[model samples]
Target: MIKLIATFCLLALFDFTNADIQADRLYELLKTKKSRNSPVSNTWSVSDEATNEYSPVYIASQDGLSELDKIVTLPGQPSGVDFNQYSGYVTVNPNAGRALFYYFVESPTDSSTKPLVLWLNGGPGCSSMIGAMAELGPFRINSDGKSLFKNDYAWSNVANMLFLESPAGVGFSYSNTTSDYDRSGDKNTADDAYIFILNWLERFPQYKTRDFYITGESYAGHYVPQLAYTILLNNKKTNQTVVNLKGIAIGNAWIDDETSQEGMYDYWWTHAVNSDATHAAILKYCDFANETSSEMCYKVTDKAWDEMGDIDIYNLYAPICLNTGLKNASGTGSINVFDPCWQYILETYLNDTVVQKALHVKPTSWDLCSGDTDARVPITASRYSINTLNLPIETAWRPWYLNKEVGGYLEAYKGLLLITVRGAGHTVPSYQPQRALTLFSSFLGGVLPPPS
Candidate 1:
């Protein structure tokens, strides 16, 4: 029986069929590789100085568009834009502990010292690669959810852009031990993300001192800040302060649940997305809490719809993939459940295959809308009910996600820049990557820009 298991494991480890051989390593079982893990896999012990020093980061300019374009090997159509793509893996806990799928697109400019940023999406289970292919990445998959297209305003132009598919269970990133996959939470996810960076440093070694920034949205407001705080704490303790850790930026973040839900419903009324009758009723009777509803309230879908009354603009709650047919009929197959937004990514993305090749990922098509994906996951109920008004930002964690500890799941971190793009809903990048780009650059530079 042991022999049978050993042989099966070896086959899984050796079956490397992919564009980049590096990616195959992620699937390789530690048992078969039998090799030691990345060097910086050690845990943090209370120490004054870091036990290790990362290699110096070599800065590059945002020039050489031609070179970067080639690196991605994206196709071009006169009507379509040219973009780049690459996919692989990074080891977070090298003791064969944790791993994350890595994706990047060389900036359009030839500059070697371009800035580096890691972008993540929320859902705790959603993959950021959707950012690479659907929203910020140079390419967008066709509506078929299988083909590829070009994205003209890819973020790589401004920085050495990268996206990750993390926490196992989501995307091609898998775990050797199901134990890791079985459990999911903020702390573990952040720790694993930190380890992934350490391993990423081991692999690239060159970008150690590079100005590194972390960014995300929605539930990621939590994922992004928490991860940044971990890096900040670890850097101070381990002496591996090489992470430029410049600044964290989040767009339309779910900062505080009370405010988020309030803003959500108010947003519906202010924008004429919700019925006046529903809005007034919510304001008068619904506590957003004891709303006299049987089902759980707050962000949970079913009850939220029954309570909010088509706040999504003649739409119920976030729609399931069932309405994908609507996208096709309306020529809207550009986005998917994988991404919350980016349907517009299709308008210009499909024309250029160069962006597709640069991303090194081939999907039958891309799902830009998060609404569709929400249908599949196990629906959740918020700890507190959604707020009835757009409240103020009080703490780090949203009321729904907060647990009495860690400040009700709200963490307070210094040096984070918050951005809210007007006229944008849900995922900002998919809806407004350009606006997101402006906010991102300002955050990295440690400055706030005037809102549009």
Candidate 2:
């Protein structure tokens, strides 16, 4: 249904948030209307009745993650690299035979003192390995699609990075019962991730008390916040420090559909991507304030996309991968601009049997973008509304500086934080690695990026 709606608006060419935005935006408005007449829980919990009927679907168990911990040796890892890398599955639900695949990279130096950071990618079904191998991880896929190179600005340099392929049917993560995939949603995703983290900590007790943070992009605007909310709820329930959660930082976050979509159209107009007439039409016809827009809104949106052409919405200025056939092209340094073909090359590399074996990835085909291909875990917009609305206080928006220049803007609410990578698109780190690293290091240190 969400995908069907994207067809009406030119498929997010004008709005990077895509169909999930409308789904969430509409759901929130409806939920708010409903909440006016009834009560809703601040923290979501599985009822005994629901659990008793469905819980038995879990059919397996694991006591520790130690045995699952593994050392990875990529085909062309840079020589003399000092960090330890692990990739394997951590059973989140043994009875249901549910497990989440993970890739962990310790800091190259001082692994003990650095904070632990979990990174998720939002297709709601996308693999964080995309973040690991192509974005901020220690190693990047060579253009040849068969080797690796070091990422100097990798977030792992400042914190231990852990990436997961979650909700089953994503990347290599799987469940024995096919029904589990069909039942996946925001709440279950968060619930399972919370358990995954807890079980993961038990496996690596050394970092049981380490400061933790969650970060991701795109739909992760939903994932990161929901997971953080879940952790906070558990913390209150136990009245004790659970996972030592510090804060979360999301890049180009899609927190609220209405605001972000409005901003996107406004962005197109201001950036000259939309014609003056079209921009005015959008402004006049679109009612993002109420979630769903009018038919005229859809018409103008289509016109906006027609003018934008086949550009990468993720980075309006970034080049598109025109030479995908040349997967073996020589790699280049991480520059202000990204390698347009990186995604193509990454897919080729990750789908290789040799690469999959090395990473302990289940023998399944891999793609750079999931694009909600898995029906089991539909993008649940209500999760965003639920988490964001249930928060005890509103987030305070402010500027964060680095080296005397505005690094980016930020919003903080209790234990959660939202960040924008200045001039970056959907994937912040890819287009602005330095700015991303600055944002990341600051968040981990519990300080704003230093003033320019």
Q: Which stretches of candidate 1 lie over 4 Å from their true place?
A: 1-85, 94-97, 144-147, 269-304, 307-419, 446-452
Leading candidate by TM-score: 2
**Residue 65, model 2, lDDT:** 47
| Full-model lDDT, candidate 2 | 0.64
- Over the stretch 23-60, how does candidate 2's per-residue lDDT look in tens digits? 23333433342343543323234452132122212213
* Model 1 C-alpha lDDT per residue in residues 100-171, reported as the tens digit of each score: 667766676753687788888765466676566656776666554435555555677778887877776556
What TM-score fits each model? 0.59, 0.78
Sequence-dependent TM-score of model 1: 0.59
lDDT of 1: 0.46
Q: In model 2, where do residues sit more than 4 Å from their true spots?
A: 1-68, 238-241, 289-294, 330-337, 371-420
